[model samples]
Target: MAIDVKPALSPHLVVDDAAAAIDFYVKAFGGVEIGRVPRPDGKLIHAAVEINGAIVMLNDDFPEMTDGKSTTPPALGGTPVTIHLTVTDVDDKFQQAVDAGATVVMPLDDQFWGDRYGMVRDPFGHQWSLGQPVREVSYEEIQQAMSQA
Candidate 1:
């Protein structure tokens, strides 16, 4: 029998500075801290935050620990994976993140795929793609747009 999971998937971030990362998330994305468990050494063992009703788990990197084989995105050079985000107002959200210390990787623009989209790299070195659906575009429409370009 399979065990039931409340949230089957959650992104776990390992950063050099978990506390700063947590603060960044709160200010940048309006995330609320659900809880945090600190180790005896005052390092974050685990933390949970809610972003737009979804929980994101994170912790400070502890390569010394058996369970902590993870390194920060910078330590790994860069992350290939990016978090895709949707908001009611993509432009506002993108600016909010930028104002909170995220660097704009891609300027916000309307895409042929029908989304107002942009990308930002947070201070903690995580890349986020912010988007808002502007209209419903069929596959044929996308193909036509691509062909026109």
Candidate 2:
């Protein structure tokens, strides 16, 4: 059966370096390099990657696309949304991200939702949430949690 669904939440990051970001993503989250498009000047125009079963697309800083060229993440400070990836062992995954040049935004620990979770920001300034569901929570439990908060 053919399933029609979105593959990834593609986020465009205007980075000072694109190739380094690709390498970092690969080592951090086991991202698979799907494809890359290069411009005539031998610079990456676009690139795609599959990380933890989700597709993430990125490109170099292109002023033509955003009106003005910005080499940093954004003037607004950082990204509004954080990319979450569900893995088997979030602790190990979080460590892997750190080893791959990502900064640990949140230390690995248990959450109120009954999951071992953590967050990291890639070298290019993209934040990621790694988590592993440790136990299943019932609707009542979820309601209680919500009420407590």
Candidate 3:
């Protein structure tokens, strides 16, 4: 089924190759490609994928389309923004992403905030953080943990 909920905020990515990025997202995060609109030159002008109930929009790097303002992460050295995904199985999902050609940026570890979390960078230069809550963590406890850390 297609994404039913319309999120107030959704990430829109400018990638070097929108089609390849969509394929990678599907393999790595079990994303569903909802739609794709291509330019006359055959490059994707707009594409939407749904992952974990959220829509992630993407398009090929068309500098002319944005008055040369928008660029891909590689062109900017690296991305400062990281998409975060909350999953039921962080380890499994993390491994799946890795198996699908994502490079590990951080090893999966249990954090003081009660989550098993890690990060990966996809081949298209997008970074993603995968997290799973392993236990209930109170604000006070988190504060204490932060203080200790």
Candidate 4:
């Protein structure tokens, strides 16, 4: 069965190995594997995982299927996008991801915007940011903090 809720916007990642990425996400972020469709050559054409009540879609990089366009991050020299995950506990989730083979891109700390936030890069070259709300900050407050920084 597919995921129950349809998200208006979901990030679709093209990875070198969809299976491995799925496994890593499950181990690191407590994601639930929704489903996967495999190609004839054993590469995944599509896969979905649910983490923190949201669905993330992924597939194996298939340049041939996309008119030789580079799809994977490494192939493109790196990705410019970072997926932000809002979790209940940023510190715990960040550590869990690190334990599961993710490399820390930033150390988790309470920010002026009132969140404990940090970033990590998955083995597939995808960057993910974990955040937990520590307190509610107004837009003006955030703007002031940004100006000061």
Candidate 5:
């Protein structure tokens, strides 16, 4: 019998400083610390945080995992993935993130697709797209809307 399976893969971000990253995540996105593991040397080996309902895993740079040195993708220039989140109030959440030190990448605005969407870069250097569904559009309506655009 073929079994169907779906595993939720939480994006893992390797930061040069996991402690600061955790604090930044909490402030910038209202993330809550779920757990953390520290090395005997006092370095954070791993940590998990909950943003809304999803879990995000983070850790201090472990060169062994990469090539001998690891750092934020931004420090290396660009990132490979962007984390997106759904919220009830995109505007207020976006502002709260900004007040907590996130850099606004896109101002919150209602889009043609019917979501109040915006983007921000957390102090930890991760990009996040915050969105709130404004209206539910049928597939046919969306197609028509896109065609008109």
Candidate 6:
């Protein structure tokens, strides 16, 4: 009956330490904590956050449900997917994440796609790609660059 959340495709993450992860997101990515629901056991059942105008839901892993398949990225031998963030200043954003305990997966570099980009592995084993648009490229230029790469 309630329709407060409007994002149709928000990502829901399961973190081993939801509280810490929430704090990290707030500090490193400028996320706003909008709502949180906690369980009787003092674990978070659900937490809603807004990151750069996009909703990203998260919660602590519940081993009781789904037969313990709610494992973290490290437990599953690393995640195949990476979260990408587009910020105004790639350098500043990248450094903030690093200072907040993210390890560099790929150093910052300007790419053929006309963006300053870099990758990082968060403390909780999540990979994040930081990017900032530096220039606009035509479709033909992108095709040519793709062919060369």
Residue-by-residue lDDT tens digits, candidate 1, 1-149: 99887845789988888888899999999999998999888799999999877889999988877454658888889999788888998888899999999999999999999999999999888898999999999999999999999
Q: TM-scores of all models?
A: 0.90, 0.85, 0.91, 0.91, 0.85, 0.90
**What lDDT tens digits, residue by residue, belong to model 2 across residues 122-146?**
8877788999999887878988999
Model 3, 38-144: lDDT tens per residue?
A: 98887998999999989999999988877786589888889999999999988889999999999999999999999999999999889999999999999999999
What is the overall TM-score of model 6 with all chains considered together?
Answer: 0.90
lDDT tens digits, residue span 1-149, model 4? 88786547888999998999999999999999999999898999999999888889999998988898868888888889999999887888999999999999998999999999999999999999999998999999999999999
Candidate 2 runs further than 4 Å off: 1-12, 69-74
lDDT of 4: 0.93
* lDDT value, candidate 5, whole model: 0.85
User: How many residue pairs clash in each candidate at the backbone level?
Assistant: 0, 0, 0, 0, 0, 0
Clashing pairs in 4: none
Worst 10-residue lDDT window, candidate 4: 1-10
All candidates: CA RMSD (Å): 2.6, 3.3, 3.2, 2.6, 3.8, 1.8
Model 5 misplaced stretches (Cα beyond 4 Å): 1-7
Report the Cα lDDT for residue 16, model 2: 56
Model 1 clash tally? 0
- lDDT scores of the candidates, listed in order: 0.90, 0.81, 0.94, 0.93, 0.85, 0.89
Q: Compared with the true structure, what per-residue lDDT tens digits does model 5 show for residues 35-132? A: 99999986798899999888899998877877776677766775767799999978888998899888888889988778899988877678889999
Clashing pairs in 6: none
Q: After superposition, how far is residue 144 of candidate 6 from its true place, in Å?
A: 1.9
Model 1 residue 65 distance off true place after TM-score fit, in angstroms: 3.5
